[model samples]
Target: MRLVPIQSVKEGSILAKTIYDSEGRVLLKEGTELKDITISKIEYLNIYTIYINDKYSDAVIEDVIKPEIRQKAIKKVRDVFYNLEDYNKNQNNYQGQNLYKKSEKDFQSVQYVARELIEEILSRKNVMIGLVDLKSFDDYTYQHSVNVAVIALIIGMKMNFHKYELFDLCIGALLHDIGKVFLPNEILNKPGELTEEERKIVQEHPKNGYDYLKGSYDVSVPARIVALQHHERIGGQGYPEGREGERISILAKIVAVADVYDAMTSTRVYRKALSPNEALEYIMANGGTKFDYKVVQAFSKVVIPYPQGTMIRLSNGDIAVVTKVYSQMPLRPDVKIVYSEIGTEINSIMELAKENSIVINGLEYEVPEDN
Candidate 1:
């Protein structure tokens, strides 16, 4: 199965994986053949790309975390956020004992899910994290949390972190933005630029999340630090705390890189999502200033700059689909030539690292449906 942009998807193509809506409802089941109406519906839902079975491309992109595990993790995050929101709405209504019990349960659930996520990522270190941004505007917070956890765990694995360290890192990454649950909906989802005061209010999330976790008994110190310091930069420019250099915890440093990357790549009310390659470049460029250089290097090693099944234009003007990614050379991957510059068919696979004269010039947003 190969991943393809929705614009290039044609009728009769088999769906390789089930598509789910923001509410966890399955919209298209696996093996369902795409018809015009189905395609239109997917497009209407704002889905940009999907997995489809194609004989021409044998490339397979696997999810680092299983679908069931991911769904459960998302649901767990949603539940915790919902509980927090509910508690804020009626803090006086619930007894202290009852509230404490609920909070404990939620923290336990997060730890269990975090361990599972770490194991899943460690089990498949070679598989590039290629999660599609299928989140709806309403569920953005929950989905974004899960995405950060997965990305952080991947980077941590590449750094050879121990199992316990990985667990703390994953938990911290998952709840790094949990404080946003307390922000007003209008300010959190505002489509326009924020005022100076509003920006300061938004920046208080790290402290707010840290305070929330500090009261919990199950959270580790590393995890709490992540919630507090994920936004702290190496050059003392970050918010909540302008911590620089060794002042920032290693766990928070890893989470910070993951948080920034996921935030940039996710679509928001204010801006369009950056492509994965563009997001990575932004992170790399900011390394040692906005992010820890070592953590950024580990992230670059694990993530695929140009993921498989993505179409690209070579410097030679050949349009091809990425067939495979090499760990050593992420910028250049194997590509299967589907069309020449003149738009003629040419079925040939080229290992980009072996071809010194060719380089990917640009990514093709749309490809011929007939191919």
Candidate 2:
């Protein structure tokens, strides 16, 4: 299967992966032929890219969690956040009232999903982190929460967190953005720069989310703190509070990196998504400043910048597709040069580690200006 931009998708192509909405509803299933209507519907939904069948491409992308389990996790996140949103519509938490009321079942449901994700991920010690999930503009929050949790769990495992600590981190990372549900939809979905006043309101989401989760009887304090401090940077520049390095807890620091990585890689209304390599570079660049150094280091060791099936450009001016990924050497994945510089078909696969001279120069989804 080959991933392609929605604009380049042809009507007769077969979907290579199932597309799910925020509520775990399947929009389109794998192997289903994309007709004019389905293509149009996908575009209308604001989905930027998708995976489709390509006879010449042998690249395969794998998810750490099963599709059924991942979908349920997304649904669980939806349930927890939506229920809180519904409850908030009636109560006034601004007056120091506890937000969650009889929320034990809801909290436990999220914990169950988190436990499932942690177990599934830990079982696959070699699972490479790939930014391949399909999500729409409207599905951003629910799906993004799940993806962030997955990424955070992987990074935590790489750093060798204790079993109990991993559970707290997983739940904390999953509900990190639970505050956004209380914010106005207009501001949350705005496609342009925010005014200073608007920015202040947007900044309240972390504390707002913290307050909401703090009142929960089942939610752990460490998990609730993740919602509060995920926005806090190590260099004292982040919002809500200007906390410095070591002052932040290790759990929140880890979730902070995970939160930004997925948010940067996931396409949003305001900006196009950064390529996986590009996002990794950004985290690496700001490791000591905006993010915790240890967390960023763990992120690099765990994630696959170029996963299988990625179309990339080589230094020799040839267009190639990623055929294999080396977890320890993320920048040097084995690639098959499918076409020469002038678009001539070559179909030659080479291990980048052995070919010391040929380097990856570009990504297919790379933004024009970014290139």
By lDDT, who's the top model here? 2
- Over 4 Å off, model 1: 1-12, 22-25, 43-48, 54-56, 95-98, 125-127, 131-133, 342-345, 368-371
Candidate 2, residues 251-321: lDDT per residue as tens digits?
A: 89998888888888888999988788888899999999999998999999988878788888889877778
Any idea how many clashes model 2 has?
0
Q: Which stretches of candidate 2 lie over 4 Å from their true place?
A: 91-99, 342-345, 355-357, 365-371
Note the residue pairs that clash in candidate 1: none
Give residue 183's lDDT in candidate 1 (0 to 100).
85
Q: Weakest 10 consecutive residues, lDDT, candidate 1?
A: 125-134
lDDT of each: 0.82, 0.83
Query: Candidate 1's residue-wise lDDT over 127-204, tens digit each?
Result: 565645456566788888998898888888888889999999988888888888778988998999999999999999
- Highest TM-score model number: 2
